[model samples]
Target: MTAPFDDLRDESQQLDSLVAALTPEQWAAPTPAPRWTVAHQIAHLAWTDRAALLAMGDPEAFAAEVAKALAAPESFVDDGADEGAAQEPAALLARWRDGREELQEALRAAAASKAKFPWYGPPMSAASMATGRLMETWAHGEDVAEALGVERPPTGRLRHVARIGVRARDFAFAAHGLPAPDAEFRVELVGPGGELWAYGSEGAGQRVTGPALDFCLLVTQRAHRDDLAVRADGPDADRWLDIAQAFAGPPGRGRPPKGPRPGPAA
Candidate 1:
């Protein structure tokens, strides 16, 4: 099995390569994320990377920081982004690159399986933190890619994302103050390389099936569930599709369908 830390590094490098080629005007272009430009997306990632490093290195300080953010929930994330986005494009890029390196080193220095790291949502194991970072990188990369009108090719790394999406089914429901469904659903995805990845029992009454890319897109709120070729069987499975979120946070309002639902991107 691939380590989440390795996947996190790969995802970051992919996004970094994309951003490295962007012009100043392109860096300032708006993304699908509300009121956030390409610079804002990278800035947010950089900020989170710094916070993750703090959580790994100083639990008390990280806890205090989380408390401060939670106290002003509505503006905490936005305020951080706004502040970071004010930097010049060169500064923003260098900050992100440095933060990414620092975070990877911190995660590697610890015993990933046993060490717990503080986060905005809850304490997480190093492995989970790495996975969450990978998810965030990919999701934000989508925003950056869209802003540049460039379509990124799907990769097997999405399996990490899909696994998180499946695992977060209950969290998704609970985050919205809804009771988690009692049923266990089977998830089967066709990977970018045409390999099959299955989670849960095949005979499970509830099932979600689709291209892995689309599933990741839906879970990350990068694309509306309706826009993907994903299908859910059973009421609980269907509801999971409506609220699936891979990244930690409040329940996200996913994209609305644009015209008739389109097929999954190649």
Candidate 2:
């Protein structure tokens, strides 16, 4: 398997390729994310990569930025995206490409040193950071793809996203002001190649089962849980499906179901 940093680079490159040929008009096209354009999506990625770089290379500066974010928690992310989106498309694209490349190099070095960096939550080693970056890249790329009317086939990299989602089970509950469940829940997902990726003990009574794509989309808040094929076995597991989120923040206003709820897999 490729290193996590390599995987992150590949994910960023994939997103870069998607936008490399887009016209300025296409860059301006609005996405499913309320009021955000395709350019805003890429800009957000660039801003985050730079923020990660700051956290790694200069903690003091990163701390100051964190304070700013905390001061305006609701608008910080959008404010950063808006600032970058105001740039010309070509300039914004160049900025994103350069920033991601720099961050990828930093990640490789940190991985070798076994260094940990600050995050919104706990500190993260390079591998964990890379996995997180990969998740956000794929999630935001989905918005850009939707805006452009493009289809992105699932890849093995989604396993990283899935693992994060599965691991974040407790965090998801906490984010929604619910107590974390005590019993371990088994999660089994069908990967893109039809392989079963299972987590937790098979003996566990509570379980979540479905296509990996749906699970990943659910955890990322890119798709509503009701619209997905993912299902939960026990009441706790079912409640979990209602508010799973891979990313950190106050609960998001998630996208509505695609149509009438297909309901969970049974």
What are the runs in model 1 whose C-alpha is more than 4 Å off?
A: 261-266
TM-score, cand. 2 vs. native: 0.95
Task: Write candidate 2's Cα lDDT for 223-254 as tens digits.
Answer: 88778899999999999999888886667778
Report every candidate's CA lDDT: 0.88, 0.91
* TM-score, every prediction: 0.94, 0.95
Task: Give the per-residue lDDT of model 1 (tens digit) for 1-266.
Answer: 24788889999999999999788899889999889999999999999999999998888999898888869877888888998899999999999999999888878777435778778776888778888899999999999999998889998888889998999889899888899988789999999999999999888999999999999999999888778999999998898888888877777667777768468999
What lDDT is obtained when candidate 2 is compared to the true structure? 0.91
Pairs clashing within candidate 1: none
- Root-mean-square deviation of every model: 2.9, 3.3
